[model samples]
Target: MSERRTIAIAGGGIGGLIAALALARGGMRVLVYERAARFAPFGAGIQLSPNASRVLYAFGLGKALATAASEPEGLIVRRGRDAQELARGPLKGFMGQRYGAPYLILHRADLHTILRVATEKEIDIDIEMGTAVADFALHKNGVTVLTERDHQLEEHRVAALIGADGLRSTVRARMFGNDQPRPAERTAWRALVPADQLPPEFAANNVGLWLGHDAHLVHYPLRGGSVINVVAVVADAWQATWTGDGWNSPGDKDELAGRFSAWAPQVRDLIDSLPSVTRWALADRKPLRRWGEGAVTLLGDAAHPMLPFLAQGGGMAIEDAMTLGRCLVRGEDVAVALRKYERLRRYRTARVQREARRMDRIYHYSNPMAALRDMVMGARSGQKMIERYNWLYRHKS
Candidate 1:
């Protein structure tokens, strides 16, 4: 009988955990090395589009995910002055029904728990917490992942090394050298409020978006309508950090109101209502020259960290895990699998990168003429607008 191959997954974020779970369940011996000491499953909310939710449903995490998630009626894009919705469409679960899944917005910790619980059920996943990969050496047969402590170096010649590690991936950095990630010209301030804390208008289940001059806001419910998560974005003069301190940070409520003072009243009311908020600058990397080298290859944010305008960052990473597993499971030779995986993912992710960058201008449009152009955008009509995203939101592979 052929022996099941061994796989090493670096980084324990959503991508790493999901890849580990997928591979282990596929009958591969798996060991996941997370740099953190323990996993508390913390962080704010994230949106799971159909492209991603289908995979979660396949994992049987739908009920758990749904409990902590909410599907907005639609995405309401508004013009700043009067808060008049510039466009409205069926974007959440409404769009998901057509695509075979749902768009779910849930607290990050909840989804983490769901994945962790599912993977721990029957999989022998050796999760080495508080362990960071110091370096690596790759060969034809397998790869070695090194950490700071000497006692845990269990070297094995595996079939492949999956770098599900994130944007600042140590594996990719060791192989490709440290190229600087470009700073996106915007920063984000995120906050969450108890449902009752929100006014009656916001208490209703809906996702609200207020598009302004060089800024925008996204708000929706989470934890089965118990809490509302608000993310405000604005163009800034400086670049921001990637790793946040975890959880929402305290901010000046009046200052928060000041930033959006010119925005529509509904937006101001929401910001003004928040007792506290956390702010961070948004950062992104340009596309890598290539994503794979020998037996070591990249996945998720390590391979592509686009702008967050599409709300697909986590969803795309989940898609990466599924697509990569599909490629790897198709063959006996691991190198062939890795190559196929990279080929399948690059084009789609690159196009997403471009589209995300294009949205930067859309959110930051300050000129009157730019407003007119968008006010009558032809892309809003017909299936073309929805169809254009089909290549992304509708793909199963």
Candidate 2:
């Protein structure tokens, strides 16, 4: 590939890998830089709605995803205090039929593996482990990227630079200055339990949502029903006291259990059954008016980090990758193409970020507000509930 067609991507995450694959399919050579020495089995379960699955299938990953993912029958929303069902909505078949792609739930690691393997098979993609994008300089021809590996620095010039380094991204900091992400004042505790270890109700092939006062719980099957992934989010005031090596940190099982002690027996039992859990302090930033400048741009969390209330954090990233690839392949000036990509994606992603925050408020409603929410949700039929988010699910990009 010529220098004009080579793109350097910072961060070997889902967004970065997917961007590489998309760019490769568009006839561009891609180099992916990952700070980790190798991919590790990290993270819990992730819900890939039709919007995300559509892009992955377009990349010929349907078979790989089917092998590792679980297509849940539907989603069940309940009131946490008494486990009262508020709403039930279809997912698997309905989603595929309505939006042309299946909704999938799987371990985060499994999805990462599928993307990694797919990138490895692409001749135009090269992944460099144990390297991090330290800095970059944009010139008339291209961007010169400085990468660090074991305290040594190396420079590579590429037609464009993509900052997919995720939240707290070094690339983003360099591009827009270091504006700290606004904490959402909440913490998510996540764990995976063996299917056989829980009651049948907990192991059912459906996504479960339990909404409470200032907290919520979500669970679904993963890896072909071998394990059940669970996440509990609660209000936290101790962000200043949080100490950890990274966003994901070991959590106190007892502390998590106490948070849900007032809930129903099923909810309490679910918390108690977990052997251990990992936690992340939920946070996001106000949407950016611009994602990049000149030949350098941003993708995924690096561009727009959001709370996980709507389960579209990863989905939006996938959409960004596809949109960016389409924009870049138009043979326009690299900077202009990147700006076009930003224009195409900015509104949709900003809307999702706003919606996720709105959902965070809805899910954590207390008393009268919670009652009104349940009444409104319960009055709607399952199909109606699904249709409410048509804007989100019906998106092709």
Candidate 3:
């Protein structure tokens, strides 16, 4: 008896695209459906820690990723007049020691382009943009994907269905009803301004993180030190929304300053004096109750959406793509393989989501307890603190 061999991935963001590349290269046919009309180069930079970069390197993308990657000397976390030398896990030896891959920090656009282009060149995958997935019907043997057209919609069938679709994934909605997303009591403003445009002090080769009462500001260089990527997160009671490049969403500079008003001079000054910036609320979802059911499964943000505090959002998705691809390729039965993949991934991703939540709170600590925490960090060396996070970085899957 022959089992079905093809797979369908819904969503064309970083996760879906990478999954398409992985599954196709694994000798499985893959078709990726992207709901967006066009891919927008909107996101700021992403810190792809060693854990996820390991997967990227395995895809034979080490060289290409290296070209677009930026390596900061380390992290600098400040709280008011005091600061701490927090952990900066092995950026140097992460890849070689743990998974034979180095950590790569890159602008989201660069990674997107590299993955999309590399997949198109190396795999037999089909990508349809402006195609919104309306729903899916799980049958006895396979699943049928219904896609909405300009005026109508139609169905396409495949043996396996993967919902790499993002945050409010329709596929996940149909599979696991949309529950309340994790709210982190803050808004994150993202924007990319040229390095040359900012104050000379900001162009440093290190990552600057200013932690204040209820907010934090981060700055790092990008594109070979040509442009600076800055992200400011502050407390706001407003509902979390993507607000990405919307018509009413002006890239206002003043609002950026107002949020982190009482922050350290470096942070307040960085915000008020910045040439440009954009802002959006950060939201997350508790780990999905299930990642797979029969022939269909979820991946990346759809399955596990974490706050951006740990800078592992995209990296986790990349890891999900690689792990699922390898699992299916090696499993004996399609159904059995899917189940194993879910079991293996569910625990790890859930842990990461929790860790990210912890980081979000620690980054914005303001009370006396925060001072004690800061004192503890100052007394310890960065490497010692970093060692505590090896569990996160040293993970194989």
Residue-level lDDT of model 2, residues 1-397, one tens digit each, is 7888999999999999999999999999999999999999988898999999999999999899879987899999998989899889998799999988999998888999999999989999999999999999999988999999999999999999999999999999998899988899899999999989899989999999998888999999988888999999998855657776666678899999889999999999988889899888889999999998999999999999999999999999999999999999989999999999999999999999999999999998888898888889889998898888999999987
Candidate 1 vs candidate 2, lDDT winner? 2
Ranking the candidates on TM-score from highest down gives: 2, 3, 1
TM per candidate: 0.91, 0.98, 0.92
What is the C-alpha local distance difference test score of each model? 0.76, 0.92, 0.76
lDDT of 3 by residue, 126-232 (tens): 88888888889888878888988675798887888899888888888887776756666677777777776667767876677766667777888888988878887
Judged by TM-score, which candidate is best? 2
For candidate 2, the TM-score is 0.98
Error of 1 at 51 (Å): 0.9
Cα distance off (Å), candidate 1, residue 196: 1.3
Best of the candidates, lDDT: 2
How many pairs in model 2 have backbone atoms within 3 A of each other, for residues 3 or more apart or on separate chains, i.e. clashes? 0
Q: What is the alpha-carbon lDDT of model 1 when measured against the actual structure?
A: 0.76
